[model samples]
Target: MTLLQAFVTLPVLLPMLGAAASVIVSPRASLQRVIGVVTLALVCVVAGVLLVSADSYGPVVAQLGGWPAPMGIVLVADRMSALLLLISTLVTLAVLVYAIDQRISDYGRETASTTFHPIFLLLSTGVSLAYLTGDLFTLFVAFEIMLASSYVLITRRTSASRIRSGMTYVIVSLMSSLLFLTAVGMVYAATGSVNLADLAGRVGMLPEGLKTVLALLLVVVFGIKAAIVPLHFWLPDSYPNAPAPVTALFAGLLTKVGIYALLRTQTLVFPQDHPSTLLLVIAAVTMVVGALGAVAQDDLNRLLSFLLVSHIGFMLFGLAVYTPSGIAGTALYIVHHITVQATLFLVSGLITRRTGTVSIAQMGGLAQTAPHLAVLFAIPAITLAGLPPTSGFVAKLALLRAGAGATPAAEIVAAFVVLASLLTLYAVARVWVRVFWGTPKEPLVDNDPNDELVVGTARSARGMYVGASSLIVVSIVIALFAGPLSAIASRAGDDLQTREAYRSAVLGPDTAPGGPGPVPVAAVPQGPAAAGGGAAIGAMTADDAEGTTSR
Candidate 1:
């Protein structure tokens, strides 16, 4: 095996090992933080190396213990996997810092300080492995790793409210896991193997009805994980109940994992299917539903949670189209959304820290008192709103441009996307007006006309803003480098569409899984953005909460 091939496993391997090390030193919080940060930082470095190797020499594939494909566990890294690896690692690191601060500063709440590092590291291990694994069951294992750790993290806060929400999350996640396992069983029973390369060929050859059935089963499972409409009810409740750091982590990475699986399976298993049409309908509904839900929420975290579901629809739009532009756009959007979403949540934590609540009506003129926080909030607020020159705008423009030339169905989906974008702006704008702008006004009516309002003493933690602002800077960096990033995304999209190189890379050029010849290496494509083809897309950030009590 080549050196690069060997390097492909480090992202998962290093983190797993580091988690063990962190556990050994778990009694020491400072040491644990150092270990966690160093370990994940190294993981990021390895991921960058793998990304460079993949970009230079097609998809990198490494078989575990020299076991061959379809039998041995395999690791594969291409532009997409590598890109996501970097994103996930960086986000986890930032959130780790934020979480550490929360544990230290918010001692009023229960914080599992000792177990946090190990569990968080394990969570990173799962996310890394999920991106790298080339076999279906291995992906399943990866999911469990993440889910198990997530269960602990979400339930770390011992309040009755959090426990109730955690139970809901656990039940829903268990159900999705069952669905995923069942779908895999069916796929294995039909295809005779579970390796992605093996299934790639087998999936295409299945009878039309079976193919559609299999695809939809997989879609439903991922749909739940991704929080698609009708399946997203758990998010608004479960997410907001977690501590702010956990909320940020779950919001940024968890649903995206579901989306990542969908992307992988969509290209490898059903490359030629017209499922995008169905996805378009779901996308339209998801967008409207999520945005409207966001509009109706008074809890800041819950409002963000609904918006999370809505934006997933945007990514769905790109994936549904099955074109180079569509996939690239989706990829870019995922990255943008992750950073901006995390930034907003981090800002949410900062706001709550100062005001003791996320209720907009209880908040009074944060802009005047905390100008630095206001500035931090404003950057991402505008970025998330799809304002000009921000990465969000660029990503949306790419999706719209791609859809503009697609089928009539795609055109209709595009209209819904535009409507959702405007509505998203309004939702964030409302937050700006209610939370950051005017006075903190009390309600005119109350429960039994006797409700009481509690105002918290505003306080600032030393390192909290540091961690939060880092993510805002990340979002800004993404916007600034939209061109190169889009080109890379375009290349990944092309590679996904041209599945030959991937299977051959993993299964070997000589014994390409489904073919009789050597796998041909493919070149990365330069995106339309390289030529400045579309209108400049910019972004803004927003989130808000308002109370419904009496004065």
Candidate 2:
């Protein structure tokens, strides 16, 4: 295999290997920390190289087990997946560092537990698989891996309240999984294959109603995971109760992974010539509702969780526009949100360490006492609010420009974007004035000593600050280098919308969608009717059935 192909698998494989090694070296906290850090750093490097290669050479394809796509496991890294993977690895690395320090600070150096590092690495593995996998079934498997690891992380060292919240997260996640699996079965039944490039060709031949139903089904499945508006109820309760670093990781990567799935599948299998009106409406409602929810929240983490839900609308809005510029805007927004949201959550953890409370009303005089922490919080806070010269502003501007065309639907959603940003500014400014500007308040009494997030001392916060600050610097750099980054995002967006390059990369050029080449006899159904709705209604011949694999 070529070096680029090798780079494609390393991002996923390295984390899985790291997780296993961490488990074997369990109970040795320091060594495990080194392994986790080094593994993630290497993955980040690989991801960066993959991004450059993909941009220069089109998608990088790696067929595992020496089998071709639609028959065996396939991993494809295009500009979109490569960029998201790179950002995810970097954010997870920073969060892991903050988590390591928090563990040592709350417990001790030798007392830090073993499960955290392994489980965290597993979470990163799942995310890598979700982004890199070239088939729908593999995506389902990736989501399951992520859900399993998250279940353990959410409930680890839990109190009754956390257990209750974790249960809500689990039940909702399982329901989504079942729905996702059902959708996969439906797609396989309809298209005779679940390989994304294969389906990209075949799904277009199905009846319009069936295709629409499948598209909506996948949207609902991913929407629940992305925490978009009406589907986001479980998130506010579930995320805030976890230890801060875990919350940061989830906020930064989990929902965005869901958005990535939406961007990937909708553009490939369910390509639309016009912007989707239904998606646009959902995006507007999500933006308005999430911003309003944040305004009412008193707890710092819960408020940030609400804002996380709110910004998901921006990504959705970009997708709903269904233009290359819209998709590019979404790409930029995801990168910005991943870094800024994670930084905000980590800084919230630092504030909890210093003040012993997450309640915005209860925190006071941080600007005067913990001035460094206040500065740390302010930068991300303003970025999250989409103020000028930050990554958020650049991303939002892209979305606005994309939606600035003649369509009323795009115009309406663009207005909602502005309203949401204004509300977000108000909500975060309230946090700033309430938490950082008032007379100093004493630390809240440790009502729940079992909750490590609010019970930790600030003595060992230097590493935590470093972790959070690294991302803060990343967010700022995104602003400073917005031109090149925006160019990359635009190219990635064009690649996603075009679909030809991706299909060519995954299923060789001979079998790429729309290519002037012979179709795989097993891929196309027998008759004209069979080629259309025939497959959906059991039109596959015995020989064809024997030829196709479950993947």
Model 1 whole-model lDDT (C-alpha atoms): 0.79
**Per-model TM against the reference:** 0.89, 0.95
Q: After superposition, how far is residue 131 of candidate 2 from its true place, in Å?
A: 0.4
Model 1 lDDT tens row, 1-551: 47878788888878788788888876677777778889988988888888787777788898999998867889999889899888888888888888777666655333336677888888988998888899888998899899999999888746667789899999999999999998887776555567887678655544566678889998898898889997899989899878778888889998998899999998887785343778889988999999999888887888889889999999988899888788888888888888888888888877766666767667667787778988988888788778888878987888898788788999999999899888888888888887878874432222221111111435446667888888888888988898889888899988887787788888777666545223221100111123232212100000000011111
Where model 1 places Cα greater than 4 Å from the true spot, the runs are 108-112, 273-275, 440-457, 513-551
Native-to-model Cα distance after best TM-score fit, residue 255 in candidate 1, in Å? 0.4
Best prediction by lDDT: 2
Q: Per-residue lDDT of 1-551 in model 2, one digit per residue for the tens?
A: 47778788998899999999999988788889999999999999999999999889899999987798877889999999999999999999999989988888778789746678889999999999999999999999999999899999999997888899999999999999999999998887766678888788776656666778999999999999999888999999999999899999999999999999999999988998789999999999999999999999999999999999999999999999999999999999999999999999999888887788888888899899899998999999999989998999999999999998728989989999999999999999999999999898887666777666555355645789899999999999999999999999999999888888998888888766553223544545543244355454435442333344222
- Which pairs clash inside model 2? none
Per model, how many backbone clashes are there? Answer: 24, 0
Please give the TM-score that candidate 1 achieves against the real structure. Answer: 0.89
